[model samples]
Target: MSDRRLTPELLLGAYAAGVFPMAETRDASEIFWVDPERRGILPLDGFRMSRSLARRMRSGRFRATLDRSFPQVLDGCADRDETWINGTIRDLMLDLHALGPAHSFEVWEGEKLAGGMYGIALGGAFFGESMFSRVTDGSKMVLAAALDHLRRCGFTLFDTQFLTPHLASLGGVEITRAAYRARLARALADRASIDAIAMDGDLQAVVQRMTHTS
Candidate 1:
């Protein structure tokens, strides 16, 4: 193992290898690497949108955009009682975002940010780091947008890193590490981009594309 430091290059390499960094808590001084034996992944082809959520999206009460507010989105994700986003991780993410391997998806109601998610993209794989919602179903809405965006961009893998009941409810599943590595390998071999999808800040397209894909 290397006494690794966090940089855009190292971070992307870690992701391509099916490993990631985390802190024990928001205040932790050191970052640690986690390569779980069981990895959680959300398949691009299997993203599920419940009927009510789909209705909310179709109604167009909220709007969605990509890489619009990377910093705010990261802060939102780390704004919890306990978090893994320490100062070091925050700085590393900011640097990565500036370098284009990172991306953010935000849901909005008028001028207010309702919810958002931020993650890293390497080749055809997207590592969904964290998310936060300030309005009902906000995070979920952003997730739907992200799924549609990735699918349109020709992405093959979406790694959530771990599963929560919230994620599992929306088609996220766990695979053995070996399975994850195989999927990761395939994704790393392909090429994709967030902009490869024609999102164009169209909320309706977010719903329509997801519906068509799912």
Candidate 2:
């Protein structure tokens, strides 16, 4: 299917089928589907919290929020030198967000957006598309809080799509495509909502809970 034919329903259906669209560059007008042989996923119960990340989490230097400034978060994630989030993808995501399952987790330094991540949430699985950081450990902070939020909200699978060394250090692991499909199937059959709980609680308490759990 062509990128021009891609709609919010089609995008969500693609995610349900374990395939996603990508572009050659941010300016690319066309997009293609990608279904990797290996999938990167962060096990909800297996996130690694190092001393520094834990300390940073408890420092109260940043606050975490959900679905706030999603458009800004999208801009942040695509602000890099090279990105696969082209205009078509960005527009589609915006439409998806309006239709509801898509969400963004944001980390803030006072009124500034330090970092954030966005993804498509279907049933019990959250397909993390991209994240960006404007400050040190900003993306990491968002990831930590996103994981905690997902866990508390009853999500079962956190699909990072591809594992990077950064995510590997934070407990992301690669699994066979078959294994990933199995997990995805189960998750799709289950039920969860990223918006089920609010992020209005204490940041330090989130860190403490993650520290004890991890």
Candidate 3:
């Protein structure tokens, strides 16, 4: 393992090498690299939108946006008691965004941020870093938009890094590192443009598309 600092360059390099960085705690100044034996990923074409979530999508109570409120989204993800996002990690992600290697999706209700997610985009792979929700179903709304956008953009992989119960409910699954590497390689071989798709944040439209394709 290389003792590289968590600079933008190092972070990008780590992702390129199929590893990611994490801090020990929210207050930790130092960061470490992670390459888990079991990797969590959401199938772009297999994302599950439950009947209730689909109804929520049709409710039109929330709105979603891409690459908006990125910092706020990052902060929201790290707002919990235990977090790996420290100041250094935050700055690094911001730098990645500036270079167009990172992107975010945000959910809003009126003027307040409801939920959002951010990640690094490389070729056809989207490495999900984190997400949060303030209101009910906010995170789900943001995820729906993200999945739609990624599919429309021709992305082939949605790497969540690890699976949680919440993620599993949305069709997140675990795969061995070898399997993940194979998928990553294939995804990295293909290229997709996230900017090519013009996405509407309207919940109904998002669900309509998801239902039609999914």
Clashes of each: 0, 0, 0
- Candidate number achieving the greatest lDDT relative to the actual structure: 2
Model 3 residue 212 CA deviation in Å: 2.2
C-alpha local distance difference test of each model: 0.87, 0.89, 0.88
Clash number for model 3?
Answer: 0
Write the candidate numbers in order of decreasing TM-score.
Answer: 2, 3, 1
- Tens digits of lDDT, candidate 1, 152-198: 89899999999999999999999999999999999988878778755
- lDDT tens digits by residue: candidate 2, 46-163: 8887788778778878899999888999989999899999989999999999999889999998899988999999999999999999888888888888989999988999999999
lDDT of 2: 0.89
Candidate number achieving the greatest TM-score relative to the actual structure:
2
Off by over 4 Å in 2: 1-3
Off-target runs (Cα >4 Å) in candidate 1 are 1-5
The root-mean-square deviation over C-alpha atoms between each candidate and the true structure, in angstroms, is: 2.6, 1.7, 2.4
Report residue 5 deviation for candidate 3 (angstroms).
3.8
Residues 118-176 of candidate 3: C-alpha lDDT, one tens digit per residue = 99998999999999999888888899899889988999999999999999999899999
